[model samples]
Target: MKAPRVAVIGGGLGGLSAAALLARGGCAVTLFERSKHLGGRGQTSDVEGFRFNLGAHALYQGGAGMRVLGELGVKPAGGMPGAGSYLLSGGRLHTMPRGLVSLLTTDALGLPGKLELAKLLAGLGRVDLAPLANITTRDWVEQHLSNADARAFILALVRVMTYCADVDAMSAQSAVAQLQAKPAVLYVDGGWSTLVSELETRARDAGTRLELSARVSAVLLADTGARVRGVRLADGTEHAADAVVVAGGPGDIAALLPADALLAHDAARAVPVMAATLELGLSRLPRPDALFALGTDGPWYASVHSAVAKLAPEGGAMVHVMQYLGGRGPEASEARLEEVMDALQPGWRTSVVARRYRPSLLVSHWLPTAETGGLRGRPSVEVPHVPGLYRVGDWVGPEGLLAEASFASAESVARALVPGQQVASRRAVGR
Candidate 1:
């Protein structure tokens, strides 16, 4: 039989990952991206001599995505994890817990909060691995710490990082993994976009075909239920393929799916209101050393600047600040930063040589089932009775995250296709 032709829609990490893996598997893969470039919300912008990561306030090497990168031969960009954060309270900036010493005396949390957090973290770190698909981040955090302060700290951070406006909507299982994490958030020396750019290069070198500005409108299957016939593009062109993976957002998959198979899709709406407001300029220059400060402390504002020296002839350091505001309504979000900008630094607002903002998927419904959150009417693992189509998302991972969840979900789909030895030899692939 001829090798399958796989068409991956959406240029996000999940889609790119699927395409890369399928290509490595010897399948003829065609990746379609609607944007001019890959990397979904992962895009970074350079304005007036400044570079800014629009999403992901902070990321480190120890996350699921980092693990996947290691397997793919990518290394962390820079040195030790960037400086940590603190909560603002009573006009004084109070350091939040970053390690054993800080945890014992951090002012933002009480003794009870710290002890409970320690218990949860230690317990989760010790517990046997379980499938993460069935748990929500909220449940996990509550289970471990149960302290209002700790929960707020963790959930608010997740809200900003994951674009989750509805903090309570995340998975307990996913939450458990995050809170237990080691503090080694990593970024490429240049920026996170460079990582995606690297993946694209490596993938193409490995024989993957990338088609940007192209959107896959539909994943069509023949009546035989044995093979995926092809994908229908937005332009109405049909490209034939033997297999198809919906690595785009699960919602995108549910939309293209056939009516008969629609029931097979989960109706969980992830309510993550995400926003990234980046301001770039040579407004603040500091010594080429660790300079950490709270926007005022408290969970409300936190920031870090990776100084760029000799970056320009004048030698002014670049500043890229990331701000996340909960779903306070669009009008409110529009004014949040402006109102706070002057309060933080009086003259920097004018120094903002360039500013760009794009916020989407602000909210996504978590899975709607006891297995996921607490909702009903969820999709089955293999798409009900359908044969050629499969879904991958945070909800599908053995556990989910940028790297682990996406990788697990994609591998699960790949294995279900390759068949046999799934249990004896799980077809796990590092995302």
Candidate 2:
């Protein structure tokens, strides 16, 4: 018997991971993507001297995240700076406060401020967050952070990095995840795109039909109650499948599914995020030992991943600085990016070589629920809403960091195919 035919939409990490797993399990999987590329937001690009990371600035693979990769036999390399971060506070670049002793001794914060931070950090795990889940990050910080100095110096540093979020609208659960657990900032080695490429390659090699440039518009159901029939693409091509995982965006899925079924889904609320990447001449660099820091002044927020010694040519180095903009993104993000570039490195006219960016591509995506269960009553990734149609993505809900969540959600969707389906048939072929 032929394996069940599964249609995996969106070529991003999650979709690719699901397709790979299903194909390997003996299901004939076809992966579709609307973009010309496969990585979705998980992508990379090259300019004059800099290589830009599209999305997912970092990943936390300390526990469950790491376990998921192990289950998929995926290994990753470090993507962020290793030593740590330097902060631009009060017009000066200071070393980041690490331990309790360091926090207390730092002149940036007052003695009382340090004490407050001490109390806060000590109670990190015990803090009641549910009441604060719907509140914004700014509100959370102002309410709980008692020390002004710590608020400005330490918390603000995190704020700039969007620990709370660019708009400060992120839930306490979202921000608390960073402060509570592993507390380590990291990136995939060789950039995040490497991981996406790995998943795509592995899945395609495993008998999966990876389809790019395909757009899925809706899932059509038959007369049978709760029975999912197949999906209809935007271009009018219909692909039949035993089970479908709506792993795109929750808001989008909610809009596509019948209103009756959508009652169970919370309308995905996503904030905006805009970023900029600049490629410059290595000669303009201040040297490797010069610590990377972000100024509170205009648009620049985060900076790292400059392997001056490795990628720079002769005496010139390349660096990519990312600035996240919130609210009314597209135009505002581009405008701020331009403003930040001109302000941060005013010497660009003389010291820089070339810079490239897509101003209009700026996207404001939805945030994931604090936990998988945070959705409370949302449908399962394996369980279809209108019977045969399922859902996936951060909007639907992310496992954690988007990349990992995408993979997890997609896999869950793939495994949901019913018994005797092609997927089941293939799995039982040799057994």
Candidate 3:
């Protein structure tokens, strides 16, 4: 019998990981990317000694992305500064309370509020989130806490963790799970594109054929729609395969299929929570010692990326500021982010060397809605009622969020394609 031939659409992380694993398992894999380059939203651009990524991308120390990279023997380099993060509160920057000492000493919260917060954090790990799965984070906080300061503080933490500003729509269960996990984030020495580059190399090394600038017009299906035969290119070329995998969001996948294609409704209706990001490469450090910080009153986060990674040139600084727009447009959200930046880094705008603004990417992809079982109710990698067809992206269900969900879907697809084969050396989560 001949080895199974697979055709992967989209050259993002999920596609690359799946292609590499399948090819390594003795299958013939051909990865197609419509863009001239791979890495989708993870791509980076370099200009005049400065590097700007698609958005603010960070890898959690024990995240799915790192674990997957570790399986491939790729070690990312960087470290968080010892000063840790800070929060903007009451017209001042206060150190983020981590332990008993900081919680008691930090002026961000009142002593009573701090004590209450400590209890909440301590109980988050052991709390059964099942009962709270259907409630919003806002409701949960209001129900459990009496202090206004404590409520606002926890709301900010939830926004920062879930990347969703609408606390009323955010799932309490998801927030608790993430806060409990407490994943350590890292900035790669160069940029996230560096990791993408490594994944591309690994795929090619595993005998996966990657073709750039090849636009897939549509997935070719069998007579009964039971299996995907291959794909037809935009330029009228046809490539055959035993199976097909789409490494793109639901919206992207919908565009490639027929108007009445199966699962088109789900793809179209799957609403994604978006983010607005402002990245500045400065001539000097703005917040020189801080690694990360959050706004206590709103949905904003800032990080001195260069403090943790060598992202800036000598004597230069790299800062990434992001705003989670609950329902705001780019212009409005960008303005708000600028305000946060101005508040946090006074006189810092004068030192800017280069800046980029990205306002439209699915930060959390699907909204963590308790009403919808959070991510647990998301669509599966396999297209419903279709065989030999799979979808791999953040939108795919695998009990995770963001990049972690992407990695999980990729691994799941690879395992389904190559039964009994160990595609990953160890399991890891992505951010």
Cα deviation at 32, candidate 1, in Å, is: 2.0
Q: Using lDDT as the measure, name the better of candidate 1 and candidate 3.
A: 3
> How well does candidate 3 score on lDDT at residue 376?
59
- TM-scores, all candidates, are 0.77, 0.78, 0.93
**Candidate 1 local accuracy as lDDT?**
0.54
Q: TM-score of model 2 relative to the true fold?
A: 0.78
Give the better candidate number (2 or 3) by TM-score: 3
Clashes of each: 32, 15, 7
Which wins on TM-score, candidate 1 or candidate 3? 3
Comparing 1 and 2 on TM-score, the stronger one: 2
Model 2 RMSD to the real structure?
A: 6.2
Error of 2 at 337 (Å): 5.9
Residue 316, candidate 2: Cα error in Å is 4.8
Which has the better lDDT: candidate 1, or candidate 2?
Answer: 2
Off by over 4 Å in 3: 81-84, 259-262, 327-331, 423-431
lDDT of the structure predicted as candidate 2: 0.56
Determine which window of 10 residues in candidate 3 has minimal summed lDDT: 422-431
| Cα error, candidate 1, residue 425 (Å) | 9.5
CA displacement after TM-score superposition, residue 63 of candidate 1 (Å) = 4.2
